[model samples]
Target chain A: MDIKLDQILFQVLNFGVVFGAIVFLVYKPVIKVLDERAKKIHDADRAAEESLKEKDAIDELKKKEKVRAEKESAKMMEKAREQATELKKELTEKARAEIKLDKEKAMKSWELEKKGEHAAMRKEFVDAVYAVTEKVVGKAVDKKAHAGLIDKGLKELAQAM
Target chain B: MSAIQISISAEPIFHLGQFVVTNSMFTSVLVTALLIVFAVCANRAVTSTSKNSRFRILVEFIIESLQNLTTGVVGTGKRAHLFGPLIVSFFIFILVNNWAGLIPGVGSIGIWEHHGEENIFVPYFRAGTADLNMTIALALISVVLTQVFGYSFQKLKYFSKFINFSNPLNFFVGVLELVLEVAKIVSFAFRLFGNIFAGEVLLTVMTALVPLIIPMPFYGMELFVGFIQALVFSMLSLVFFNMATIGHGEEH
Candidate 1:
């Protein structure tokens, strides 16, 4: 095989130039574009993950708020029930007191009416007795006998007084 | 009828001052030009924001494959980035040159010259890898660059791989390693040159004997061989670069 220095040198130079041209013209740019694309994909993934985490956080907060609101509503309902019970009890007690007062007032009026009736009956009886005595004396005795009985009655009355 | 003669040497096509440009050199220049043109077009097509064009996609595929290969061989991260471009360039240049040889007129169409008693056919174009000069040149570049990468990576420790003055066994091992380094140049050059030159001669002989459908299978085989040789050369170069960059004790 023939080996020439000049030829070898030329071929080396040719390869070197070709290598440099390819590296500069094609390889570097292609690699750069690839790296940039990979970076973009990574960034997109990271952002999506961050958004997911935020969404989860917000959902948790919403859940907690819902629970708190339910509890507050339950407490308010209980308070309302308690207040209704108290008002019912107070109204019943007031009605019972009014009925008792009415009964007492009716009893006092009945007693007063009964007492007046009794007194009227007693007065009527005394009048009747006096009339009967007068009739008996007028029928059976004379005027003088009547006058002496009246004088005796007057002396007994003075001594007794 | 005269017998077909294949010369081992590249035939000189023309002269430029003292520099004699051969058929192989001419083919080399043409291949380089073609590659440069392709590179320019591919560069223009590739953009960071858009990835739509077929050309851009093709280039990206090639570059990505090369990146993976380099990363596989040289490990990942910065070292892969540093050597990836060169390995890719070598593969492309050699592959294109190898395939370019298969074109109809490249090895067939040439001028016939008169020797003392016979006609000597000299092709105007030869495959770049078929020439010993070209292969040797490429091997030299690969070996030298390996050394450069070695020094750049390991500094003074790179020399320790070639020489160890501490012990007898270590020194002997260093010497063996040094011999192997030189042998690598021979191995690289001959492997490429032998494969491509054999393919060229095989095609030439087949065409002479049958000149018909007989050479079709051989042509296909040559195409496969060419591609394989290119891959082999670049892979070996990548291996060498990887070896050079790491410490001798480091795992491959």
Candidate 2:
């Protein structure tokens, strides 16, 4: 066996040099890149998870907003319906009052006309009676006293009718 | 017919001052250079974000696969990161060295030296792991790092595993374990060196015996052995590291 101390030492030193070269030149840098890529992937996954949670929260908010708007709209419709009913009631009352006032005024004007027509008929009857008397019983009659008596009888007949 | 010259040890190709540069050492240096070049290129490719190449993709696939294997054995987080590159480097180093023997010119192409009446064949390149020095170095590195990991993880508790005096039986077991740690180092060195060296010898002999179409199967077998040995070495190191951190009958 050719075992020599110096050669062994030299070989060991040679291998040691090789180990150092490989570690520095190859291993460390490659491992660094792998770690970086892994970290980046992990960060991307975490970001995606966060975005998903945010989207869920926004969806929940949207649902609540829609419900709130629906409730508000329903309340507005109810209020509008109440106002319409009130307006219809108020308008009906005013129209009824106007119709009643018009009916009363028409009744008053018809009654006044009937009174004027009765007065004119009475005067005409009085004038016609005086002419007839003059024709039938001619000469020596008292005009004032007979007229007064006929007028009183006609007034009594008009009041009874 | 020329006899097949198989040597259990690496042949010295040249000498610089007192330092002897063996063929195995020469190949190791070459492998190291190639690995460094590949690393520099890979570093450039990996660090850049503009374009992708198939070479880069294949390298990444292999690296990620090795990392995953380390993760499975050692568990992830920080420990895997620390152990992965070392384990991969071991595999790559041993694998390249093992396969280097299979190259056509590595064991065959050489110079003839006159030693008196006979000539000796001394190859310029030999498989690195086939040498005892290289394997022992690897084994020593593994064990030392294992101890370091144990201490770093368990602190004071790690030493108690080797030097426990709570009971006689426990003490004996501790001593046995300590010896076993040394045994582990020998085991690591021999297992790698034996397999790679034996394969080289077997190939040389098979070629010498036939010198024709028969050595092809042995070459294929060597390829498989080369890969298996590399895997075994790296995997064992990783397990030892894990065991050291967890330390004796303790749950991880």
Residues A49-71 of candidate 2 have per-residue lDDT tens digits of: 99999999999999999999999
Model 2 residue B163 distance off true place after TM-score fit, in angstroms: 1.2
**Alpha-carbon RMSD of each model:** 10.6, 8.2
- Measured against the true two-chain complex, the DockQ scores of the candidates, in the order shown, are 0.57, 0.46
Model 2 spans > 4 angstroms off: A40-161, B247-249
- Alpha-carbon local distance difference test for all models: 0.88, 0.88
* Residue A25, model 1: Cα distance from true site in angstroms: 0.8
Error of 2 at B104 (Å): 2.0
Worst 10 residues of 1 chain A by lDDT: A121-130
Q: Give the distance in Å from residue A60's predicted Cα in candidate 2 to where it truly belongs.
A: 12
Q: Clashing residue pairs, candidate 1?
A: none
